[model samples]
Target: MRLVSLLVVLLLSPLGRAAEQTYDVIVYGSTSGGVAAAVQASRMGKSTVLIEPGRHLGGLSSGGLGATDIGNKA
Candidate 1:
């Protein structure tokens, strides 16, 4: 287990480096909020980095959610 963890760390180190290369905002989540945040940040002239544990882009969106679960739509 330790070796596997170390291998994972080593493999993901590059990604970490890339994320730190230069960014005004680093959003960590694959949810809709995360993508929206990134876009808004970029539009504001801020380099944005969207980091998510999952490989897919949007969490529930790409996972098969026809509609978002924002109970309280402001």
Candidate 2:
């Protein structure tokens, strides 16, 4: 009985192992913040993946803004 059960379990088990992608961090979006985060993660020696909805990066800056110029601090 034990042998039969063991054999059944073994046979019922998945024959192929699922391939898993491991990453320390996953950044969704290639915007400035996303790029910065990914770069920081890479600098820290952690794996990172940056995904962008658009074809370009740098978000608004890449959209012909040239420079962000978020004002200056007093």
Candidate 3:
């Protein structure tokens, strides 16, 4: 009985299942750096995915801070 149970458990285990997805690069956020990383990965011919936790992208840039200057203008 113990052997049979072990065999059944092994048969039902997910050890041999292949992953549903494979990405060369995965960006965890939709912020400027995350977007840039994803873009760079794609530009280098790599598969990439950009995941955002919120309903929008660009973080502060898209959060009503449109007039903020990010770089020095001197």
Candidate 4:
């Protein structure tokens, strides 16, 4: 859900300033998905740039909420 929202925002963002620079792919937010997108673009021989507004990456998981279901499932 979060990824979808991010994508929408990026898609709607203004392109005037962006038009000055050229890139095969521009991934907003440094979330895991963003990283993957940039990586995939690079693998395809395209110039890719990953932009992160925050000072860190990995989204909430890297923001100290990496806890998982380690308890018994039963």
Best model per lDDT: 3
Off by over 4 Å in 3: 1-19, 66-74
After TM-score superposition, what is the CA distance of residue 62 in candidate 1 from its true location, in Å?
A: 1.5
**lDDT of each structure?**
0.85, 0.85, 0.88, 0.84
Per-residue lDDT for 1-74 in model 3, tens only?
99999888877889735569989999998988889999999999999999999999998878878676657496
Clashes of 3: 0
- Model 2 worst lDDT run, 10 consecutive residues: 65-74
| Model 4 pairs whose backbones collide | none
TM-score computed on alpha carbons, candidate 2? 0.58
RMSD of 4: 11.2
lDDT of 4 by residue, 1-74 (tens): 99999888888889523667789899999888888888999999999999999999888768766566456487
lDDT of 2: 0.85
- Candidate 4: stretches off by over 4 Å: 1-20, 68-74
- Candidate 3: residue 21 lDDT (0-100): 92
Clashes of each: 0, 0, 0, 0
